[model samples]
Target chain A: MTQKYYAQIYVTLRPSVLDPAGVAVRSGVQQMGYDNVEQVRIGKYIEVTLNANSEDEAKTQLDRICDLLLANPVIETYRFDLTTVSSEVQTS
Target chain B: MTQKYYAQIYVTLRPSVLDPAGVAVRSGVQQMGYDNVEQVRIGKYIEVTLNANSEDEAKTQLDRICDLLLANPVIETYRFDLTTVSSEVQTS
Candidate 1:
């Protein structure tokens, strides 16, 4: 039987990578008088729902998708959390 | 006293909002033979480091920022997690 899984993936720039967006945000914060703001990094958050035979398959699929398309391996790193959707929602 | 804090903000289209990017991702998943994939919502993940007097202050500042500039109140909803930076990291 297949189960529905939900994954939340966060893709962020490596510490060494130049984050122009982050810099702009930092500047904005400083301009707004939030003088203590620093090292602001902007990233992408993707939420995917899919079906698979098991947790391992769900994770494998998501990992493949992230590595191939969702994240840039040279400058960005990604992490994700996969959760099994309970049937209670299906009944509701 | 001010302490350094980090926030991870996830901005996503509301359930009622139309998500064209999500539609394209869904189509891509279907083409890739992931027939079970659904609701591929795309969003922005922002990481910010700043100084705040307390955890409550941190949340308030972030919430205000999200409402004012980070997220589009018309179509997107946002949530965030705030964590304090340890002094051990400051020393290291």
Candidate 2:
């Protein structure tokens, strides 16, 4: 049976890098009626669902993937979380 | 009074767009012991905190910003959410 795993990865730039996208979002939020908003930062969120034998193995594989391809070690940093669901779980 | 807003924007490639990153992540998860993993998709997550006068205004501004700069409408699509907190709320 195939077990399902959900992973969320967040990627962001180091503080030193310029964040034009973040600034634009900040300004947009302010215009949207949140005048109190002060600062804004932007990043990437990646979600994946995969089949795994066990939670531990899935995490280990995901780590390697992040290091090798998903994340660019030279410029961006990333953090991820993995969750497992039994194949028996109902999917609507 | 300044209001605080937290916005989360998720950006992803259209289904037609090839997702090499997503494929890499899926393979990585499988390698880690998640043999059951089947498919994976990758996208961007953007978080921003900004100051605005009212909730409505902030949302409008944020929309403009997203259209003008934060998102690349040509290739990527994005969705966002906004939350407001009173300035009096404690920040640790």
Candidate 3:
């Protein structure tokens, strides 16, 4: 009876890190007709699906992942949310 | 009159790119007591607030930013959503 879980993680550069992508996007928005646009920043989203028994356990593991690999504390920051889907549930 | 705009960008590694962070997060989830957990992948998020007159124009600039800096099409991918806030609006 394995339970399914989904986690969404967002990662971004620290304000100190130069975000060329953000700058570029800002420029693009202006060109695309957003005359009022002034600044732009860029980041990432990671979605993970897995099986877990409990939310507490899943969260504990997620934190470790963030610290060890999902984010580089030196220059990037990360945040995440978790959701659970029971194996017994049906999707139509 | 100047308009305020908010843009959220999500960036991720192409499936071809080896995601060490994802792997690490997966491992962390397991350690955190998520016995049934299976897989994890990591990515980024960027938020930008600026001034824009029209959605079309803003979109254009956003696209340029993505191509020029926000996303590295070679190994990373990006997407964005835009919202407008009138300068006349007050936040208390």
Candidate 4:
């Protein structure tokens, strides 16, 4: 039987990597008077919906997808959460 | 006493809004030969480290930061997870 899955994937730069975007955001927040804000690192949050035969099958597919398309392994790292969803929801 | 807090924020476009980036990603995934992928939506994931007296204070500050700098209320929505971190960790 086919099962539906929804995944929330987080892709982040390795800590050793310099993040110019994060630096810009930190300055912006400091300008807003939120001086307590110390640091900000920005990354990608991707939501994916898909179908598979089993949880393992879904996970394997997702990992491959992340490696191939969603993340660049050189300077970034990625993690994801998968949950089952009702198949009734249309795939749009 | 001051405490250290780490926040993981997710900022995504509202469902009704058009997501050209998502569209592009979905097509790319499909081209990668992942036919089972139904939909793909991309958004921002941010990691923030700050100092607050309490969890409530941290949440309040984070909400304001997200509203004013991280997310656009008109077409985007955001949510976050906040966790306490050891004060010994230096904020770099």
- Tell me the RMSD of model 1 versus the true structure: 1.4
lDDT of 3 by residue, B19-91 (tens): 9987876777677665555667766677878765577876776677667766788998887888886656876
Candidates ranked, most accurate by DockQ first = 4, 1, 3, 2
Rank by TM-score, highest first.
1, 4, 2, 3
Which tens-of-lDDT digit does each residue in A1-92 have in candidate 1?
98889999999999999999889887887787667777688999888988899999998888878887788899999999999998679864
Docking outcome class, model 2 = acceptable
How well does candidate 2 match the true structure, expressed as C-alpha RMSD? 4.8
Q: Would you list the C-alpha lDDT of every candidate in the order shown?
A: 0.87, 0.74, 0.74, 0.94
Q: Is candidate 2 or candidate 3 better by TM-score?
A: 2
* Fnat of model 4, as a fraction: 0.91
Which candidate has the top score in lDDT?
4
lDDT at A84, model 4: 96
Report the lDDT tens digits of candidate 2 across residue range A1-92: 54678887888887777788767766766666545557777777888776666788778777776777677777788888888765567767
- Going through the candidates in order, their DockQ values are 0.78, 0.46, 0.48, 0.87
Candidate 1 regions exceeding 4 Å error are none
> What is model 2's native contact fraction?
0.81
Candidate 2 chain A: 10-residue stretch with minimal lDDT:
A28-37
Error of model 1, residue B21, in angstroms: 1.1
Instruction: Write model 2 residue lDDT over B1-92, tens digit each, in one string.
Output: 65777777777887788889878767776666555557778787877676677788778876776777666788778788888766668777
Chain B TM, per prediction: 0.92, 0.81, 0.84, 0.92
